[model samples]
Target: MLTGQKRKFAIALMSGSTQAAAAIKAGYSEKSARSKGSQLAKDPDVIAYMHKTRGVEESANPEVTKQKVEPEKMPVVNTLTGDFDDPLDFLKSIMNDRSEETDVRKDAAKAMLPYVHAKKGEGGKKDAKLGAAKAAHSKFSGMAPPKLVVNNKG
Candidate 1:
């Protein structure tokens, strides 16, 4: 039922891209892609078609599952003890040790960054971007949108 940019946009949407991004991917002009994508996604027929195609894709590829792991949830082991341990503690110690090689300490701090809280407004800006993306996605898909939880402060 869809062709040209519509078809390409739908395909992109099914691949987890936001509608606006999909529009641009489908060859829509950058100046209007966001609005065009939003408009296309808001169409009932487009939503229905997407859901139908998604259903077929899901059935055909039943083994596919998205990996949604957060860094903190990843299992870390202390090699010395051969036991589970908080990786953040190791990173923090490395960062605080003035005698450690500068590069090594820098690497440790960089690694610890994901565990650090964002400075005030930084999180808000990220959330706003995510919101726009989600809004575009939810408009065209007849499914619940996934929520992104950002933990900025340690």
Candidate 2:
């Protein structure tokens, strides 16, 4: 006579419906047998042994051990004048080219003007504001502005 524990163990070892049904007939309660089978399914050693015995490949379940991936870092920028360099001489040299279009120079100057003005503390006299403005202005002064064009067309 198979004891309840041995019947449960036998049910867990058997696979498939026919084998499991046969084990159940031999005295294991279907519910207890199925529960034990589920427990055995979760056993790492049993799973590994089953893999070797059945010649089955073991695969990791992504859901079982997922971790949150960190986001990529953004490039840092200098706060002063919103310019990367302390002295923007390089920008000035590029803008000062005589062969460059007048409009292109004007646009570049216009874009850089705001950063310069902001850095010079023109709008606010606060020490921090003044410091930032001075830095930006000094950087701006390094860049030579393109000549102005007179357009008489209305």
Candidate 3:
């Protein structure tokens, strides 16, 4: 039966495990394993023994050098002249055109309501005229508020 600190050292050596595992196998409580590992890791004698036993001059496993292949550059698309330069530029131009079309549609909606109401025969009768006025008002209500051009010199 091993005795004293040598018993701990022998158990640590035979276990071929981490200090925590060695401590636990040597009758130490679970809670003491962490402290035992930490102390063992800091011990000069234990470190020298481990270094000698493992026969590791430097790192046992050397880092492997990876050969990196450079990524191929993509072709560009010129949007203004409708020529292919980069794919990203093509997508940006398409989105801009879509936004312009949306604005045009909104303006057209504001302008076309009166014509639409007239075609529905809404201008002749009093009830029809009131309904047309209500419809026209509602249509323009959703448009951006008109810019106020105030002359301060009154």
Leading candidate by TM-score? 1
Candidate 2 lDDT, 1-154, residue by residue in tens: 2244443343335333343453465466787766655554455654443343333355587442222212222123222244445435545644675544355556667766766667544454587787787777854476667999999998
TM-score of 2: 0.24
lDDT of 1: 0.68
lDDT of 1 by residue, 23-91 (tens): 999999999988999998877656655554443333445344232223344334323333328888888
- Candidate 2 local distance difference test against the native: 0.48
The lDDT per prediction is 0.68, 0.48, 0.51
lDDT of 3 by residue, 1-154 (tens): 1233534653464345566776676566789886876675566655544343333344545431111112222122233556748654544555455323344444555565554456655355888878877878855476777999989998
- Model 1 residue 31 CA deviation in Å: 0.3
TM-score of each: 0.34, 0.24, 0.28
- Report lDDT (Cα) of residue 110, candidate 2: 72
Query: Poorest 10 consecutive residues of model 3 by lDDT?
Result: 64-73
TM-score ranking from best to worst? 1, 3, 2
How many steric clashes does model 1 contain? 3
Stretches of candidate 3 above 4 Å error? 1-16, 58-154
